[model samples]
Target: MAENPVKIEKKKKKKGLSYLWIFLIGVPIGVILAVLDVDMGFLDVYSLSDFVAIFILFYVGVFLTINLHELGHLLFGKLLGYQFLMFRAGIFSIQKENGKLRFSIIKNVGYGGLCAMIPDEDATMKEYAVYSLGGIIMNLLTGGLFLYLSAFMEPGSIWKMAAILTGGASILLGIVNGFPFFSMNQPTDGMMFFSILRNSPMAERFYESSLLTKKLSSGIRPRDLDLLKDFENIGDMHDLTKAFYLYFQEMDKGNRDSAEEYLLDVEKNLHKVPPYSLPAYYYELLFFALLSGNLEKAKVYHEKAGKILMKDQDINGLRVKAYYAYIMEKDAEKARTLAQKGLAMRDHYPFKGQALYEEELLKELLQKIETERQGQ
Candidate 1:
């Protein structure tokens, strides 16, 4: 399938920083407060200890607010017959697998919290909108409640300050997430809500991807599932969701040439890619480059993705590192070690089908490394 000519949207650039309004407004006010000796009647901090306490409480409140936002999605999603797949806050995660709940610690960069749920097969657009906007609604409701409480509390009290700070944080979170924009390369709740409401093509792609992910989690391999037939003629190949599915579809079907073409296309139009998805994209490109013995291209992609590769503990990240160690660094022992470690993680990986595929890749890399060593 041939992609249409590139016509990028300039509005995406403007949308990138729309969520920074809180920081933009707060910084000037903070500077003004520091320049003046004015005692803000209700929010005055008297001692260094009080300031320290407020700071600590404010961070705690922010952490709690993140969890509350995710909880809102959970509660509202449940109301609409959506089944919870996972809930994650910071490094702690709880996921449902084989009808059982399991807790673990996992690293998910570029996100503060995540609430993943699968909608019912017969879910309507209204249900999706409600689920998507649930977190924002919770943030606003909690923010308002906290702000009201702070208004009634004693002036200059630590509790009052805590309430005010928490309220501000919650409101900020709500407003930032409620405004239609992309964060970490993924659309925000407001963006999803509006897209679903309008029944945009993006929304259709998003829902389709979610259904595909659910199938993956249920143990369906990419090679076994059919690709979206209509997506073959998609004009905007730069659309991440479309690119993602097509790339995987080709790769899983053992069409390396076609898969690499998709990767190279994404490389050329990277500005359209989400920031959070960059590392994974780079890793895949690096993998293909190494597999095809393109040392220079491998070097470029490895350099671009190096920071995340060094620290990302995901199964695929580990597999890529193992591949890189063998192909680029010529470290057979290190490659074997990383590949073994990745194999050990297969049982714990969230998506069983992907985990199984990664396991195969790691084993293949290990075998190749051994073959080369024996030849030497």
Candidate 2:
């Protein structure tokens, strides 16, 4: 009943964390104590100013840990041909200059350093890992470099402390990413590790890719609409063709109004999708209309969908006859002519064996139509 509804409610991502990083608050409070105890320190021009300096330092420390962790991922990705997209290190945004993204190194009391990374998708899978391992390797190496430099440097105190903080942060990022946990998706932990014990790191990747492809090819099941609603809250168009067919299936079962709404939405949302997906989408639409007894509307939609299909999309004689005879109400001679032409194309294409019922029904209907015309 509604005019052209668009069901573009792509699924959204959720925060899977148990809680906010509130447990880290203690580290900042502790740092305030350390800064306050320093005798004759430049941090305090006054007593209140001393507290402010420590608090500021505390905030800076926490900020650094998060950034460094993300940075590990970011730099690793780029050095390995990954293009960095965005970083979410919390306190500060990293700036990119001349193909190099900058970093902010801050040492914290209790927590480790933080960093962010964004990777480009253009590189091969092997190249992707080179980026993935960058953060962990760099942090470990930097900490060691600092230890050696401390022997020759006068500020052994600052470099030593920096190494301790940086080292911890680096190890934390590496372990967390390499842990082989369900949540981690980094190449080393997620894709690469699975490749190891299973002896096929590309196994999960291949399976996921295959599943998603098959899902699109088969189209969405009618019962899957409730599940698909959440998908719209996300980006969109990962499964438009299947979802649209599912909606059409809903219409097929006598829910005309709901089907119409879904079909329109799917059609509009498909504007951004590939043109290759259109033929199947249109076939489903025409099928739904025929089942719903909307012959006239089916004819209109059929033409729209039909104009987009090449002769290769379908080679089914029954479908061609049914489309012409039932949808367009064309004469039997013309309908049979088109059906025979379609059947000729089927010489190289077999009947799939699954459409046995539809094939029989189509033959019977064509014979009946021919008989009726003869009697007249």
Candidate 3:
């Protein structure tokens, strides 16, 4: 696997200390309150039921605040005239369609929520910076407002406790997301903001990837995109996007060997990819493996790929399953049925750039199958 472009920066104590600090300080304060027999009123927890209630409340509080943090990004981004591409809260996604947002649910395999927006081609760094920092600003403001409200109330009052907990949740959410941290394939907001501030080439490349992804999702084929530059190793998820583009572009042109070669390159470097994105490539790898007559490897890839696939929701996922059914299970009729369904769904498929190319490949395969049956 190719090494990650950005070194896992040594975890500086300051980088993630906000979350630790909040909990560290918050826990002790809670313990002291209990030991001192402080009658905090509605906030006082004396039984197992109260503890469970508190747990559930915190869970809901965190969920809402986290989503609100993402909403903050969307609200400010839209205000700045940036195109809202996608808003995701856990497994649910709100996609922009026909100039309106549409919500869809998917398997919850990815971490955290996201509100992704696209800037104008001529947008400035300052604009990007403001948009990037939007979530943290909202988090701080929300948390600060509630914190201030709670300060005026009696400690044990329900409103005071609710406000305090919600505010703390919001502040903690801001700190965790705002501080630099690395997920398997993505960076925290603080990391992304700082990376762009430093003019990291990876950020620009990732932005380009996002633009390409948006275009592709909107039904534009990769081959149809007019580009001044070709995809190269600028690092980050952009490499995966480029690989997908080039792989399908070559496949559509009947260059199976070249496509397989590209797929192999992706396989070798998958460690550089994020965990959530790894499954998509695995699906592609499964397809390519089957195409190249490597049934064993194809089976392995398919097993791993299936874990993250949503059959009814993902048109390309159906295509992957179709190939597996035919090539491995020897179920030509089932495969043909799925292939037809996939072809019908092509224009509406997310990642329509690859969808179009894969559709062509499926047609070619069906024809080949027919020819083989005729010889029999």
Task: Tell me the tens digit of each residue's lDDT in model 2 across 250-275.
Answer: 54354667767777667666554533
List TM-score per model, in order: 0.71, 0.33, 0.73
Can you list the residue pairs that collide in candidate 1?
Answer: none
Q: Judged by lDDT against the true structure, how good is candidate 2?
A: 0.47
Q: Cα miss at 117, model 3 (Å)?
A: 5.3
lDDT per residue, candidate 1, 1-376, as tens digits?
5543432343544554554565665886699788996667644445889888989999889988998999999999999987787798877878675346868765565467878887766777668888888898899999999999999998888889899889988988888788887655667789888998888877776677777766676677777766754644333422555566567777877888887777666666665564435677888888888899998999998888866577656678898889888888988899999999898878766666778778888988888877888998
Pairwise TM-score winner, candidates 1 and 3: 3
Regions of candidate 3 where Cα sits further than 4 Å from its true position = 1-49, 76-87, 91-107, 116-130, 148-154, 157-159, 194-198, 215-220, 223-241, 307-314, 350-352, 372-376
Per-candidate Cα RMSD to the true structure, in Å, reads 6.8, 16.7, 6.0
Q: Rank the candidates by TM-score, best first.
A: 3, 1, 2
lDDT, candidates in the order shown: 0.77, 0.47, 0.71
Best by TM-score: 3
